[model samples]
Target: MFSFYNGFKKFAFAMDPETAHHQSINLLKRFPLVLSEVFRNENLGGRYGVQVGNLHWDFPIGLAAGLDKNAEAIDFFTRINFGAVEVGTVTPLAQEGNPRPRLFRYVEEESLRNMMGFNNEGAEAVRTNIIDSNRNGKVLGVNLGKNKLTPQENAKDDYHTLYGTFAPLADYLVINLSSPNTPGLRDLQQKDTLLELLSELDALRLAFPKPLYLKIAPDLSFEDIPDIVDVVKEKKLEGIIATNTTIMPERGAGGISGRLLTEKAALVRNKVLECVRETPEIQVIGVGGVSTFNELWDFWKAGGKAMQLYTSFIYKGPKVLDEIKHGIDSVMAQNDLKSVQEILDNINHISKP
Candidate 1:
């Protein structure tokens, strides 16, 4: 089956990156049920499930946002091994998003750079898509972001509206203030602004409580982490997702992801984990440059739980997930572990590759 995707990649890779992305999305849109059969591991999930706040992921690894920005393929993603599927950096209104040639690939680095500014089918349309799609009982999250046109001062309004729209629909909801593509988005990560922005949602959260997370960037200074952590704790949100795509200007504009992001993202994740160490209620979902089981192992070692993947899925296809699952199976077998929670409970006792 990997050989099938390998051959298909040759054709997909020949075209522009964004076009290839659309082509793949369109293909999944057509044959999701069939694709689900080919890719899903029904019982594997029960063996390896991990708790993330109120939600339980079938496995630790999930499909990150941006891959399915519009919820177009929720049926396929949730059907596969992905423990969870997060769609959208959805806005209040439909956006065309920062012109073409915005998505670029670093083939050798197995990385990507995208200046795609929350280009998604507005909340109403996407909500309709989610209402129509089958989540297969797997966790489904919607990553919310302000529309490109929404002013910084009114940023809370966008989030408030998105929260109102998705809370009942999604298993969990993420407040994305991390993507570097959007202008002035990161500014909201500042402690005062973050508090103010999240405070606006307190009323809605009380009315309809949902597990919420603030996704932060890898580019943020280490000193800035505690403040963000404080904001999450103060807001009584579920946890934080660290970190989002990084900006490497030398590589050009937009955020850098995959291999290019590993070291930097890990640093931020560790910092976040360390900050939240005293507060077990807060979980840090490691993202960025998460390729194989090694990264997941490292994250577990640092007291982190589940993480998400984007670029690695592009470079290695579904086989990457299978390999990671195989790795978990082997480690658990060797250590006489029963479940993923058991491994995490005795994480330091387990052997690593």
Candidate 2:
């Protein structure tokens, strides 16, 4: 099956990237149940199960946000080998996103640059899709982003609305104030604004308490990282997704993901983990540029409890999840470690200052 997809990938890449994405989603949407049953792996999860915050994931590798932006593939994805499948960057109101030529691929770098400005069918539609679908009892994370037209000051309101809408159905919720495509969105990452947003959301969570995680960017300076970590700790947050994507020139315009982000992501994940090591309440869900065993090891070495994948799924196909899980299991055995947690525990203990 992987061989077939690998070959199909060449054909898919020949077309416009967004068109290929829709064509792929259309296939899954057409035969979701059939695909679910075909790809179901009953024995794939137990050995790698983990409890981050209040949720127990079947494994550590998750399908990151942006792939299934509208929760269209939740049923299909959850049936596969991933520990979790995150859906959306769902907004309060749907928008067309940036423009036509938004998504691009650099085959040599195995990276993607997309300024897809949170295009989706909005929060209510996504929530309904999840409620109507067969979730397969797998962990489902909903990544929430504000509407593009919403003023920066009212941004927290958009998050409040999305949080209310998604929290009931989600295993966890992500406040995605980090996507570089949304104009002035990354400004939310500024210390005062970030704190205000976190504070507002934290207060709201008291009413419907669920694990809330923040997705940050890889391009942030080292000086700004500790403050981000501090906010998570102070808010009594559940986890932090180490990064979104990088905005760099060499990788061309837009947020760069995949191979280009590997090193920077590790550095960011390590810094966040190191800062919050003393606080077990905040688990680190490493993202960005992780598609291989060695990269997974770097994340674990950096004290990441779990990881997520986006662009890699585009380049490598669904088999990437199993490959990564097997790689983790193999590496654990090689080190005589019982599980990924053991490696994380060791990192936490050793890095304690």
Candidate 3:
């Protein structure tokens, strides 16, 4: 599979990034069941089982948001053996996203930068796709966000509408307040704004039950993390997805991806883990610059309960999943650890600053 992907990349790289993405998605959708069957074996490689809240995933590695924002590829990805797939940054209404050339590749860095402003086929269209496809067995998480044109003060209403519409279909809900592409989106991460946004969402959760995760930025100040922790605890949210795309270094118009942000992500993960470790109730999902097995191990070592990927998948293809899962298992065996959880417990003690 990887050999073919490499050969394909030789041609795909020449095309525009967004064009390549659409082409690949179209291919995946054409033979969804066949693709899923091809990758379904346990030995095909991925962390076999991981638990988050009430949901139990078949693997810890998953395709992140922005890949299938409209839920068009849900059936396709499900067949491919991902433990979970997070779809959307879906808005209250449909959007075309940013203009053309919004997605760019820095081949030298093995990274991608994009300012795709939460474009999607709207919540209602995505809901119809999911319902019609009937791809419900695999764990599915829906990432929700406000429209680009929506006012900051009106953001809560947009989220509330999406939550009500998608919550019944999602195993988990990710509040995407972190993507740098959307204007004023990251500002919602501010202490007071986050508190209010999450407070309203928390009240909504009572009427509709599902795990809620706050997606945060990797570029946050040290002082801001504790405030986020306070809000999570106060609102009784299910978890936090530490370290979204970074806006630092000013990579033109969009946020940069891949290895550049790994250390920063780890720092934030450690901080959040330290703040919440004593409480032990808050779950953490780590993402950012994770392209190697070592980085995945480091994320768990730093106290992430689960981890996700996006850029790495682009660089290494599906083969990276097998490599990381096998590497983690091998390292666990070398240390005489009985399970991934035990390895995580051992490292959590040693990796802390």
Top TM-score hit: 1
Question: What are the RMSD figures for all models against the true structure?
Answer: 1.1, 3.0, 2.6
* lDDT per model vs. reference: 0.91, 0.83, 0.80
Cα distance off (Å), candidate 1, residue 14: 1.0
Against the true structure, what is each candidate's TM-score? 0.98, 0.93, 0.93
lDDT of 3 by residue, 137-191 (tens): 7889899999989899999999999999988988899999999988899999998
Model 2: per-residue Cα lDDT over 1-353, one tens digit each: 57666787988998999999999888787787776555444456366777777777877888899999999888788877778999999999988898789999988998999989999999879988889877778889999999989999999999999988888888899999789899999989888899998888766799888889999998788999999888888888787897998998775668999998888988888888888878877889988998887776666666566788888888987778767767766766666777666656665443211
Model 1 segments more than 4 A misplaced: 40-45
The positional error of residue 293 in candidate 2, measured at the CA in angstroms, is: 1.4
Q: What number of backbone clashes does candidate 3 have, counting pairs of residues 3 or more apart or in separate chains?
A: 2
Candidate 3 error regions (>4 Å): 37-47, 134-136, 345-353
Clashes of each: 0, 0, 2
Tens-place lDDT per residue, model 1, 1-353, is: 67877987899999999999999999998899987676555457388899998789989999999999999999898877898999998998999899878999999999999999888889999999999998888899999999888889999999999999999999889999999988999999999999999999989999999999999999999999998999899999999998899999998899999999999999999999999999999878899999989999999999998999999999988888898998898888889888899999998777854
Candidate 1 local Cα displacement, residue 224, angstroms: 0.4
Model 3: residue 100 alpha-carbon error in angstroms: 1.2
Q: Which lDDT value does model 1 have at 279?
A: 95
